[model samples]
Target chain A: MTKLLEVKDVVAGYGDGPAILNGASIDVQPGKVHCIIGPNGAGKSTLLKAICGMLKVRQGSVMFKGQNLKGKRPDQVLREGICFVPQERALFPKMTVRENLRMGGFSMTDKATLEKRIDEIEERFPILRERRDQHAGTMSGGQQQTLAMARTMILRPEIVMLDEPSLGLAPKIVQEVFDIMKVMTEDGITVLLVEQNALMGLKHADWGVVLDLGRTLFEGPAKEVLTDPRIQELYLGGQKAA
Target chain B: MSDLIQILILGLALGGVYALMGAGLSLVFGVMRIVNLAHPSLIMLGAYVAYWAFRLYGIDPLIILPVAMVILAATGVILYKLVFEREARSAKYSEMTVLLTFAFAMVFEGALATAFTNTQRVTSPAYATDAIFIADIFIPLGQLYAGIVSLVLIAGLALWLKYTRFGYAIRATTQNREAAELLGVNVNFVGLVSFAIGLALAGAAGALVSFVFSFYPSKHWEWIAILMSLVVLGGMGSILGTVVAAYTLSVVAAYVGFFFGATWSTLTFFVALFVVLLVRPQGLFGEKPELA
Candidate 1:
C-alpha cells in the first residue's frame, strides 16, 4: 500500500543525549486511525515530536507522502499538512477563542478559506463556537482539549497527531474526546494518537503499536495486540489473559 | 486654586512622559519575562540622536522623531534575534536577561560617555521656553504639546492592540508561547517585531522629553528607577494601569515638591510603590493568572 506517511528506521533524541527513539518504524496510511500505546517513558511524546519536526531525527527517514520530511521546522511541517495537538495547555490562555482559531489559519493566505474553516470548525465543535468571544484560559480542561482538537481540524491536515489527549480528564470527558476523534477519522483524516490507557486506545484504535523503551515490541491489528497475552502481562499489570 | 490647577497641568504632563516610557519596558517584560536594563540606555541614545539631527541638519525635532524611533526599533529587533531569542528558549530566560542587559546598559553608558563626554547636554529648542495661560491655570507650551501628543500615541497603541490582527498574535504569544506556535503563529517573528515596537515607544517618549529636561549618562539610573516604580506600581503590562500610575505618582511628586522642594518629589514615587505593594504584591491590575 502507498503509505501517506512512512517512518522508516527513525532515531531521535534530545540534545546530545542517547536516542530515546531507537530505530523505530511505523506507517500511517491515509484515513487510517493508528494508535500508539506504550508504558511510561516509552518515548511516545518523543516520537510525536520527531514526527512534527520539533526534534531532529538522528537517523533514518520520515516521508510525508512522496516527499522526505527532514530538517523541517514545526511551522513548516504544519504547512506540509501535518498538525500536532499537544497533551496539555492546547489553547492560548489570554486570547479569546476566536483569536486562537485565526492563528490556526496563519499559513493559509486565502481569507475566505480560512474564515470558512473557522465557521465549519465552530459548527462541528459547539463548545468553541459558544465561547468564541471568551478568553480561552477561563475555559474548563475538557473545553480546552476540544478547542485544541478543533484548531488542528481547521488546518485540514493530512494526519492529526494527538499526544496523551485524555490526560488529566474525567472518564466522561475522555469518552467525549475519543468520540470526537472517531468522527475526525470518519472525515478521512489519519489520526496518530499516543494514549497511555492501553485498553481504551486498543479498543478504539484501528492499529496498535507496542513500544517498550522506545523500540517497537509488537505491531499488528488492534484486536490481536489487545488480546495478546504478552502485552497483557506487561502493560495491563500482569492481568490474566483475556 | 490657581496653584492647584498649575500643579495638575504640570503633573499630568510629566506623567505622560513616564507612561509612554515605562510602557515599552513593561511590555517587553510582560510578554518575554525579560528585564531590559538597556531600555533606559537606549532611550538616552534616542535623545542624543534627536539632539544631533536637530542641531546639525536643523531638522525639526518633530520631523526627526520618527527617524529616532525607527533607529531604536531596528536595534531592538537585532537585540532580540541575537541575544534574548536564544536565552528565551528556556524558563530561566527572565533571570538571565537581568545580567545580560546590566552589562549591555554599562556598555551603552560607556559609549555615551566617550561620545558625548561628562558635560551636561540640553535640548533648549524655542518651544522649551514657551508657556501658556488659560482661566487661572498656567501651562508650559512644551508641556501641553507633549501631554497632548502622549495621550494620542497611547490611544493609538491601545487601538492597535485592541482591534488589529497583530495585536491578537502578540496577546497570544504573551499568554502561552508554545500554544501560540502550535496554532501556527510565527512566535519568533512576532517576538522580534514586538520587541522592536516596545523599544520604539521608549524612543518616541525620549525624544519628546528631551525638550523639557537636561541629561547626563548618570541620569540613566535615575530614570530606570522611576520607570521600575511606574511599571511595578501599575501592574506589569497593564497599559491603563501604567497611565494611571504615572499620573498619580507625578501628581503626588509635583504637589510634594511644590509644598516642600524638588528633592522631596522623587521620594513620593518610592512611597507610592511601597504602599501599593503592601496591598497587592503583584501590583494593581495584575494578571489574573501567572503565565510562567
Candidate 2:
C-alpha cells in the first residue's frame, strides 16, 4: 500500500536548540491508526511537529500526498489537509464550543460548507452538541478531548497528528480516546499519535513504530512489536520479568 | 449639584477618548505582545494628520477623521513590515520589540519635530470651543464630539470582533496564537491587520485630540504615560477592561481636578497604578496567571 504520509530522515528541533529529531523517518498508511511509542526524549512528538510544519525541518523531507512540505507554515500544512492537535489541546479557553469549532475550520472560505461540516461533527459528538454554547475550558477533560478531536474533523482532514491525547485522562476516557481513534480511521482519516502508554497505544493501534535516540528503532505490526523480546526488554518493563 | 453634573459630563467625554487611545495599545499588546512604544507617536501623528488636512484644505478635523485613520493605518503596515516582522522571528521578541518600538517612536518624534517645529498646534474648529448647556450643566462640544466618535468606534470594533470571520481570527489569535496557527489561521496576516487596526483607532483618537487639546510632537511623551496608565489599569489586553477603566479613571480625574487641584488629578494615575499593582497585579480584567 502506498504511504499516505512519509517522513524521510527528517532532522528538526526548537529554535537554535540541538536537534531533537535526528533523521527520524516514518511511513503512515492510509486509513490506519499509527501510534509512535518510545522512551522519553525519543523525538516522537518532534517528528509529528516536523511533519505538520510546526518545527522547521533542518534536513530530509515530509511528503504528504506526494507534495513536499518543506518551508510550509503550520497553517499552510493544515490547509494542505494535515491537522495537528498539540498536547495542550489548543482550544480557545474563553471561546464557546461552537466558536472553537468554527476557528478550527478557519481556512475554509465557503461559509456554507464550513457550517455544514460543523453540524455534522456536532452530530457525531453529541456531547459537543449538548454543550454547544458552553466554554471549551469549562468542559470535563473527556469533553474537551472530544471537542479537540471534533475540531480537527471540521476540515475533514486527510491526516490528523495528535500529541499525547491521553496524557492526563481517566482510564475510561483513555479507552474512549482510543475508541475515537478507531472511529477516525473508519471516517477515512489517518491517525498518527504519540502515546505515553506504550501497552495501551500498541494494543489499540494497527501499526507500532518504535523510536529511540531520535531515530526509528523498529516498525512492524502492533502485535509483533508488542511481542518482540527486545522491545519488551527495553520498553515494556523487561520481558515481563520472566 | 449642578457643578458635579457638569464635571461628570466632562469626565465621561474625556474617558471616551481615553478608551480609543487605550484600546489600540491593549489590542496590539494582546495580540502581538508588542508593547508598541511608538503608540503615542502614532496618536500624535494622527492629530497632525487631522491638523494638516484642516489647516490646508479648510476641512473640519472631524470630517477628515476617516482619511487620517487610513493614513495612519498605512503607516502601521509599514512599521510592522519594516521593523516588527523581522524582529518577531527572534526568540527574544518581547524584549527586542520594546527597544525597537521605542527607537521607532524617537524616529517619529524627530521627524515631526523637524517638519512642524516645536510650536504648539491646535485644531480648533468653530464648535470646538462652544458648549451645549442643559439644565444648568454645560457640555464642551469638542470633548462631546470626540467622546461620541470614540464610543461609536468602540462599538463598531466590538461588533466586528463578535460577528465577522476575520474578527474571530483576531480573537482566536489573541487567545492562543499557536493554536490558531495550527488550526489554519494565518497568524502573521492577523498580526499585520491587527497592528493596522490598532493604529487606525489611535488615529481616530488623535483627530479628536487635535480638536480638544493643544499638542506638539513631544506631547506624546506625556500622553504615553497616560495611555499606559489606562491600559495597565484596564488589564493589559482586555479592550472592554480598557474602556471601562478609561471612563472610570477619567471621571475620577475630573472630580479630583475640581476638588483638589489639576496637578493632583494628574498624580492620581500613578497613585491608582501603584494601588492596583499592590492589590491585583493582573489589573482589573486580566486573568490571574496560573502558577506552575
Candidate 3:
C-alpha cells in the first residue's frame, strides 16, 4: 500500500506549554482506515491537530503526497486536500443544515461543482435532505455527527482526519460512525482517526497504532493489536493475572 | 395631542441617528468580543470630514457621506492590521482591547482638539432651518433627511449580512470562530472586514451628526456614553435591538425634556439603562451574557 500521509517524529503543543506530542510518528496509507488509540493525554488528538496544521509542529515534518505541510495555515491545509473534523460537533449551530454544508465547500468558488457535490452528499445522508432548512444545533447528537461527517465529505478531501469521531456517542451510534468510516475507505478515501474506544477502533480499522506517553508503543494489523496480550490487558479489559 | 405627536416625531428622528452611531459599536462587540471605546472618536472624525466638505466645497453633508465612509473604512482596516489583529489571538485579548481603544480615542481627541480647538461647530446648509409641517406637526428638514438616510443604510447593512457569502462567513465567525476556521473560513480576514464595516457605519453616523447637532472634539465623550446606553438597552451585538432601543430612548428623552427640562433628557438614558440591566441583564434582544 502506498502511504498518502507520513508524520515523522512530530513535536507540538499549545502556547509555551510542554510538548503534548513528543516525537510521535505514523504513516497513513491510501484507502485505509488508520486508527490511533492510546490512554488519555497520550497526544492522540494533538497528533491529528499537528497533521492538519491546527497546532504548530515544533520539529520534524508532516508530508502529504511528498510535499511538506509545515508553516501552512489551516485553510492552506484544507486547500491541499486534507480536511479535519474536530472532536466538537463543529457546525455553525444557528445556521441551517444546508448553510453548514455550504461552508464546508468554502474553498471551492465554482457554484456548479459545489451544488453537484452537495447533491451527492445529500443522497448518502438523507437526514441532511430532510432537515436541510433546520438549524444545526436543534439536531440530536448522532444526527449532528452524521452532518459533521457529511460536511467534511463535501470537500472531497484526499485525506479526512477525524479527532474522536465516536466520543460521547452511544454504542450503536459508535458502530454507525465506524461503518461510515468503512464506507469512506471503500470509496478510495484515506481516514486518519484518533479514537479513544480501542475495541471498536481495532475492530473496524485495517491498521492500528498504540501510543503511550507521546511515543508509539506498537504498530501492526488491527486484529493483532486487538488480540495482543498487553493491549487486551490494558485496553480491552482482559482479566489481569492475579 | 398635537404637541405629543410633534414630540414623538422629533424623538424618532433623534433615535434614528443614535441607531446609526450605536450600530457599529454593537457589531464589533458581537463579532470580535471587543468593546471599541474609540468608536465615537471615529464618528467625530467623520463629522469633521463632513464639516470641512460643507464648509470649504459647498457640498451637502449627505452628498459627502460616501467619501467619509470610504476614508474611515480604510482607517479601520489599517488600525486592525496594525493594532488589534496581533492582540486578537492573545488570551487577554478582550481586556487588552479596552485599554488599547481608550488610548486610540485619547489620541484622536487630542489631535482634533489641536487642529479645530474646543469651539463648537455645526454644518448649516440651505435647508438647515427649514421645517415641514403636516397636521400641526413640524419636522426639521435636516433631522428628517438624516433619519431617513440612517434607516436606509442600516437596512442595507442588514441585507448584506444576510444574503452575501462574505456576510455568511462573518456570521459564522461571530457564532463560533473555531468552527468557522475548521470549515476553511479565513477568520482573520473576516475580523478585518467586520471591523472596517463597523468603522464605516460610525463615519456615516458622524456625517449625519454634523448637520443635526453642534459638536466639538470633546462632544464625543457625551455621545459615547449615550451610544453605550442605547447599545445596552438594545443588547450588545444585536443591530435590530439597537434600532428599537435608539428610537425608544429618543422618544422618552424628548418627552422628559418637554415636561421637566432639557437637563433631564440626558438623565433619562442612564435611568433606562440601569432599569434594563436590573430587569434583564442580557438587554432586550441579547442572549445570556458571556465573559467579555
Off by over 4 Å in 2: A239-242
* Candidate 3 clashing pairs, residues 3+ apart or interchain: none
Candidate lDDT scores, in order, read: 0.83, 0.90, 0.88
| Backbone clash numbers for all candidates listed | 0, 0, 0
Better of 2 and 3 by lDDT: 2
Candidates 1 and 2, the one with greater DockQ: 2
True contacts kept of each: 0.53, 0.95, 0.65
What would the per-residue lDDT of candidate 1 be over residues B1-292, giving only the tens digit for each residue?
8898889889998888888888888778777888888889888888888788778887766667788889999999888988988867765778899999999999999999999896777676787788877987878877777777778888888888766777777777776777666666777788888889888987888788778678877678888878888888888777777888899899989999999999999988887778777767677766644478
> Model 2 Cα RMSD, Å?
1.6
Complex DockQ per candidate: 0.53, 0.91, 0.70
iRMS (Å) per candidate: 1.6, 0.6, 0.9
Which stretch of 10 consecutive residues in model 3 chain A shows the poorest summed lDDT? A233-242
Top model number, TM-score: 2
> TM-score, each model?
0.92, 0.97, 0.94
Q: How do the residues A1-242 of candidate 3 rate in per-residue lDDT, one tens digit apiece?
A: 67889899988998789999889989888888888888889999898888877889999899999999988888888999998889996888878988888888988899789989988888998889999999998998888898898788888889988888888999889888887787777777789888877887777888989887887788898888888899888766773322
- The number of the candidate with the highest DockQ is 2
The DockQ assigned to candidate 2 is: 0.91
User: What are the per-residue Cα lDDT tens digits for candidate 3 across B1-292?
Assistant: 9999999999999989999999999889888878899999999999999999999999999999999999999999999999999878788888899899989999999999999998999999877789999978999999999999999999999898887789888888887788788878888899999999999999999999999999999888898788888888898788888999999999999999999999999999999888988998788888776588
